[model samples]
Target: LKFVCLANDGIDEHMVWLIGLKNIFARQLPNMPKEYIVRLVMDRSHKSVMVIRRNQVVGGITYRPYVSQKFGEIAFCAITADEQVKGYGTRLMNHLKQHARDVDGLTHFLTYADNNAVGYFIKQDLVAVWRINGSVAMFRQQWMLRTFALRRNSQAESKNVS
Candidate 1:
């Protein structure tokens, strides 16, 4: 359940993790163009959060933070075939949201989910705005904002109690 942020320093330090993420994305998202995935995942402007279990990557999410716009565009998200339906996707996304909120100060998130992933995004509280070019728009809801604050406060409280 550990989430690791693969740094894009153009160095060899995080090469293995990046490769693992790329492989997972390739395996899970077959319809997506491989060239697109490779370019964005390796792009310096994008950042990824990988789910690491027992020193192996199980899932990951790639996103580009638009700091000036106060939003982050989620480029790709996936879990390995065997790992789906185990709630890893939810955790991975929550981790990514936290990273965006804390690190980049992003207030919203945007993603273009294909039909296959529409349900997943809906479950995560994202709504479809319009259906142009088959890209479903997912936005941050006001309730999610309040819920995130409450959850964070409770976690802090539990830590204080401990």
Candidate 2:
């Protein structure tokens, strides 16, 4: 699998990923707009990366640079249903973080995720910055410090032990 910068030619596959995410969100929220998926795809900034497997788009992460906050917000992240638990999501996220650091001049990343996704971000070393609605909603952030250091150290330790 390789990461690809989605172009107009890949919009159909991009819509598939978008629809999958929209369906998942609608099941939880119920009143989500039917056009929400398309809108997200259209509004995505240039920083988005699509994960492609055999020329098929399977996952993606969208980010927008914030000049005022001096950070980048990970607006949308989704992996296909058949592709979950295969490390694709993590790769997509890591790629996004690298892009933010190297290209966007961002040292911090923030996101608002649902309950099911909270643990995933937390496992990535993102800290809970705030919780809303009695902890049902969460806002999380990660800095380019302990998180990256720990990840690098863990990878090194694994290699050493091997």
Candidate 3:
């Protein structure tokens, strides 16, 4: 399971990979929404990671980085249907984490993952921090200090004392 991941900020030269991924998703995973293809290929703000194995796209991810929040949220991520459980997802995730930490100085990462992806996120140490719409699981990697939460707790304690 050797993976080659290429990072692209703007979406000019990676259209081929994007198109290939679209075809794979359409053919294999027909249930997957087509909106994700638009967001990944048409959007310029997303950071796209293309995972190539044997010169084809085995997986890909499109993530949005928020500098203010100091964490990047995974807009979308997936591996090929047949490629699942081969550790390719983990490799792609590590690539994104390295990009966030080394380039953006982000210590946290978040993603709205599906119920089936819960185990994968957990393996990456991203806790099921919350749930959205009582469906999608909001997973978070909290590697940085939570000063805001600490302060809020302290303030509440002081109020109780008074």
Candidate 4:
């Protein structure tokens, strides 16, 4: 397995890249335009990590580093069904966090790793920091502190979205 950090790629090339991602995690991606992905890929404040096996993208994670906050954030992460339950997602996260810690100076994560994904996220050392009234979940974990929280994205449900 190899990892690629996507950045500054051309739009045409990004669109083609999105096609590969779409093939494995179809409909699992965030509800956003391809242009948004291109934007993320180009943004200097963000990072997108893709896990490739045999030249195909099997999993990926997008995150942003915070200059004012103490932790970074994971905006989204997904692994193809065929490649899941094989510790690949955890491996990707470990690599992602190592990059953030080594290159970005981030030590903790501020993310919402859905209810269905709580167990997995917990295993990755993400603590349940808060939950928005039992909707979506929130997480925060530091290598030092041991507090736990469950996040909730109430607005996500109100918006009638999954």
Best by TM-score: 1
Residues 18-126, candidate 2, lDDT per residue (tens digit)? 4544454344433334465445545645345777767666767666677466676665667767777888878877777666666666666655554466556666655
- Tens-place lDDT digits, model 1, residues 25-55: 9888776678788988999999999999887
Residues 87-138 of candidate 4 have per-residue lDDT tens digits of: 9888887787778777777666766445456556667765544333333322
Model 1 regions more than 4 Å off: 11-13, 127-162
Q: For residue 27, give model 2's deviation from the true position in Å.
A: 8.8
The better-scoring model by lDDT among 1 and 3 is 1
lDDT: the better of candidates 1 and 2: 1
lDDT of 4 at 109: 70
Off by over 4 Å in 4: 9-19, 22-26, 29-44, 129-162
Q: What is the C-alpha local distance difference test score of candidate 3?
A: 0.57
Tell me the whole-model lDDT of each prediction, alpha carbons only: 0.70, 0.54, 0.57, 0.59
The list of candidate 3 runs beyond 4 A from truth reads 1-13, 24-32, 128-162
**Which window of 10 residues has the lowest lDDT sum in candidate 1?**
153-162
